[model samples]
Target: MESGMFEDEFQNDGSFLHDEFEDGENFEDTENETSDATDDPKRQGWLVQIRNLNGEVTERRMWAKQVPKLPVTEQIIVPFKGNQPVGTDIDGLLGQYLGRLASNHKLLPISFKKWPEVVKTYKDWVWEKHIKWEPIHEAAARTSFMMDMGKKWRENRIRLFHTKFDQTLSREENIRNPPLSIPPTEWAAFIDYRLEEDTTKKSKQNAANRAKLTINHTGGSKKLKRRSEEIMSQIGKPVSRGTLYIETHKRRDGSYINEEARQVCEKIAEIESQGTVPVEVAIDDSLGQVKGAEHYGRVRAI
Candidate 1:
């Protein structure tokens, strides 16, 4: 009887009751297989929670039976214009937030430094835009005096007691016995003095040399002799021999043999007779002896 009952239970179905039993067993096996799949060790579960300003709680949970791996530096929350909270350091809040996110995900932080130069540049720009040009006291005084005189001339009337007019009166008073105190002239002299103060030593030397040359070349007949004496005095000391030769011959005139040229020529002939050209003649071909008619043509008529 027990064998007969086991045969009935394992029989290949020809009855509705047998078929129902087989289908139910298969469904149970499928449910067990799905439960085993959910028990995988690599699967993950995560939860996120947030509390609103009004104390409302929100929660979210997720299960991953076969989730893929994420990148090492993934960001959890992206900032949006309407949702981002204000930070204490507003100037670098975005950078700080990015750095924090990078740190949480094991990434490098972006570099940041104080830009003091930007503030300084903006300040300089503002100053240049609005600042007025202020003249010095002397310049202001001169400008005001000139402006007042211009106004008076425009009105076609003279003010006897204007400050500038009074200053002029005082100048006349000093000019009689004491020194004159003309402010305009004094201002001009002051400007000249300032200019002179800025002149270099080389410039002063050149001016003195020019004055000496000028005086040497003046006064007609005796000018050549004076120029020759001046040249000799300057040679090897104040002036080079080449410079002296050039300056002496610069104005040959072709009318008369000047004493300066005669002296230079005699010196050149003596040096050449000694079998050596003078240092001056060697430096410049023009300073060498003029040949043929050109030489005698320059000699003065006896």
Candidate 2:
């Protein structure tokens, strides 16, 4: 369900605003600008395409005045408009502007197709103001700001699609349609079965490593020979350096019984009870000089 759409279209790095407007004719660093365009009607507005809270986008012409009091929230996106002063108020402006885009569809939660009904409802809402003025003001300001700039009201509807929106949609779809139900007892049994299977797999791997152990008695050193003899006496077999002898008194389930490990431990305890401590035998030095059957690629006549 992971969609690469937003990541493909919009760069998630903080430099999105910069990259988005880099190719535009009016691109400028809105962050460093000092002059306030908040009240300036002569300022040019930008026809920005932004994604809103409800995952829908439509083109809106925005000026610095429209987003002056916009709130800083995750639901909105603001494109870099050169004439607009983003300053420290970018977050809020972005949020309000996004909310405005979503407002026409979801804010009031009522549909009125007739123009008179829309006007009457708007007038009634003007008195109540439950649907905060910020979104309304932003919408009105964007329209007025665009008109003041002498730009045509083009129906050039543009949708701003980000990858994150797809994921959000997927999550909502999941909430609407969850996975099929499993009875509590069967679910618990399934979990226990999985745990047991994992434990058995690990135990088998450990058993395979233990099976690789072999007794070696090839070293010529006296100390190694003595130690090797001690281990051989205890295990009734030869012992050598790197030889593995993994014995355990208890099974993996923790039940204890006299096992190979317990017998080995008893023998070692008996050896230690005598003065000489058992040590590992070293490998034969001649083994290092032994050549393999395979030869190098070429040989010289010398």
Candidate 3:
């Protein structure tokens, strides 16, 4: 289930999840800059303007009725209220976009060890290029951006180590013939780090812990946030978190991860199939609230 458990890809390495933060580093100003020249220049700081988040975009969508027959595949850009989203979450489209850049190694830090500096550099790069995404609160945006970039960076590092480290060749040979992208010195350091005694010990412990779980999910690499957005756009309606879980946690042969998962999905599905949802929470009026949502309207799996 989406909330009940995390995807195994994210939980693969303890080192990636927990890294030592570089101290006393100066962070660049991550304020959301105005893309529109018409915007008041006086208001160019931490607090940015917002919109009406009172109801769902669907209900507020004047074109919903007029465009009912539109192809489901046709992409629609729904403008959400609260221009500056509350709290700190990097799981939105903005984060996903930046995360893609991170995965591609386009978004990089000055040094892997200088965590704060990396966040600063990343913020500068994004703000300069993406004025359209200039409404998220600075703290929230930077924290999420840094984390997403860091995770992807670490994962990519490990992937490179696995794919490039040659078993047939000696360590010196491998280090000398570094990848075109990586610097010779950095590559050598990385190789040495991987072969270090403490690093190997920690990796073994993490692997042992990961092996404790018997049931790995069938869902691929897509995060639930993106998956839910796609579903909502396709159906032209919101779906419950439980329903989302049932959709994702199923096997290729139309079976569930386990018997317990089957039971939960069945129960949640039954509830969703019923028309017991209130009129106020209609697809057009309100974003269909996930059946049992918690924490800033996010849903949890049973």
- Tens digits of per-residue lDDT for model 2 on 1-89? 00011211322211112111112112112121223223356644444444444445455555433433333221124322232312223
| Model 3 lDDT, full chain set | 0.45
Give residue 200's lDDT in candidate 1 (0 to 100): 39
Per-residue lDDT of 122 in model 3: 60
Ranking by lDDT: 3, 2, 1
Q: TM-scores across all candidates?
A: 0.17, 0.15, 0.52
Candidate 1, poorest ten consecutive residues by summed lDDT: 13-22
Tens digits of per-residue lDDT, candidate 3, 1-302, equal 00011112231210101111123322221112222111356532222111222311121121111222223232223222222222112123333344444543334532254335455656566544431222323344445555665666666666677788897999899989987666688778778877789877987898898998654555454556556655676789765555567778797688989886676667757666675653233332112343243457543431
Off by more than 4 A, model 1:
1-196, 200-205, 214-258, 277-302
Residue pairs that clash (backbone atoms under 3 angstroms), model 3: 59-284
> Which structure among the candidates has the greatest TM-score?
3
Whole-model lDDT per candidate:
0.27, 0.31, 0.45
Model 1 clashing residue pairs (backbone): none
RMSD per model, one decimal: 45.8, 30.6, 16.0
Q: Model 2 off-target regions past 4 Å?
A: 1-10, 13-44, 69-302
Model 3 quality (TM-score): 0.52
